[model samples]
Target: MNIDPQKPLLQLNVGEFLDLLKNSATEKKYEYGLKGLAKMLGCSRSKASVIKSTGILDEAIVQNGNLIIIDKDKALQLLAQNKK
Candidate 1:
């Protein structure tokens, strides 16, 4: 690549920059905390906690200190399998 002092090195409009950001990033596919899980599951927070305690979602659950995050798709799949 040759350096060009007379010409602009790069050019991007705001919309193009935003689109690039959107396409370049991977979105998180998990839910945070029991409340988030409840919202995703369409259940009460207490119910989500109960489900967490059952260990049925163990494979989908991630715990860091007191914070809990659940992989939404995996949890739903596990629940569906459990129902069968």
Candidate 2:
């Protein structure tokens, strides 16, 4: 997958993110922290909840309520458009 060097992060709306997850190649279990994810996303917990509740993000794995790791490649691809 080619990523544009100029762009940094992909600004995805709720639907786009969900589509990416639905079309992911790997179905293996993944994990990550919600708080950490919120920090990484630069958004609040509320926002994350909204996205999840709306089915924008598929939450198949959540351990101890802190840790979320999905198909990294799929996520990157979804956001990769920004760089392009």
Candidate 3:
């Protein structure tokens, strides 16, 4: 994954995002926090939050009393399905 610093990260469609995550996972871990997920999806935190609020995505885990985590693969699938 060679990302050129001078260029913008490609805004991936849902399928591409899922494939990228599948190829990048180690030990099958594909979860990310809201901030990290926004980065992965090439969107802002508020946008991600809105998407989540619309029931297109859900928290995959919650830990340490306040941390919320999402499954990237699942979110991508839901987003893709929602578009259909």
Candidate 4:
């Protein structure tokens, strides 16, 4: 059987996209530790240490037991703000 080229593709709004991402493996894949956050932000480890000291990353970063995770969306927003 052949498929129609004009068939519409699936669509998702911003909220739906966020929800789907939250429910998907993308959450874990996107989350980062302080080291990973530094890498993603294109900053040095010392800079990350300074950020940690400032506590701005406190709300953006989460510590679950020994696992340190940076909130993906929050981290992206923080990166954008720092670029300005």
Candidate 5:
């Protein structure tokens, strides 16, 4: 990494910094288990299981044995892409 002292770094006010943090935190929410996934998708557990089996959201899914975790934003994006 090269440091360029001549270039000033970006600055943010306290409110702007807080807003950025809040947006970042909301942007990458994780949902755990089938119930959580269903809640995230606004669908039933059965439908969520079916969607999981389709493998369309595989990139957003993390599984270990019986445990499942989903990246809500990524899954929603994938679903939106597939809706087209």
Candidate 6:
């Protein structure tokens, strides 16, 4: 049996990962925490720290807990405007 080396060697590229993250953020239906968002965004909890520091995504307060997800409207607006 031949094994495919490319399998598992191909993690989604940053742009692809970011696009997925944006889409997921746009579809959020419940409260999520920073760690949760980090996990969902394909970043290790450590990497999430870096991403948040970079401000591509931000933390928001929801009710009594913390929610961490991208701003869907802002992301779509930016994508829309940059297309021109």
- Index of the highest-lDDT prediction: 1
TM-score of 2: 0.36
For model 5, the stretches where C-alpha displacement exceeds 4 angstroms are 1-28
Please report, in order, the local distance difference test score of every candidate based on alpha carbons: 0.84, 0.51, 0.66, 0.67, 0.83, 0.51
Q: For candidate 3, which ten residues in a row score worst on lDDT?
A: 1-10
Q: What would the TM-scores of all predictions be?
A: 0.66, 0.36, 0.53, 0.51, 0.66, 0.35
For residues 1-84, what per-residue lDDT tens digits would candidate 6 score against the true structure? 333446463566666666656765745543355576465556677875664565444333232435354544553444355453
lDDT of 4 by residue, 54-74 (tens): 766676887877588887678
lDDT by residue for model 1 (1-84), tens: 333345452565566667666776987799999999999989999998998999999999999988998998899899999984
Model 2 residue 44 CA deviation (Å) reads 0.7
The order of the candidates by lDDT, greatest first, is 1, 5, 4, 3, 6, 2
Q: List the residue pairs that clash in candidate 6.
A: none
- lDDT, candidate 2, 1-84, per-residue tens: 333346434766566557656766665433255654465457797875554454344433334454565443454344444453
- Please say which candidate is ahead in lDDT: 5 or 6: 5
| Candidate 3 vs. true structure, TM-score | 0.53
Tens digits of per-residue lDDT for model 5, 19-66: 666765744489999999999889999999998999899999999999
The list of candidate 6 runs beyond 4 A from truth reads 1-27, 59-84
TM-score of candidate 4 on Cα atoms, chains taken together: 0.51
How close to the true structure is residue 84 of candidate 6, measured as C-alpha lDDT?
Answer: 34
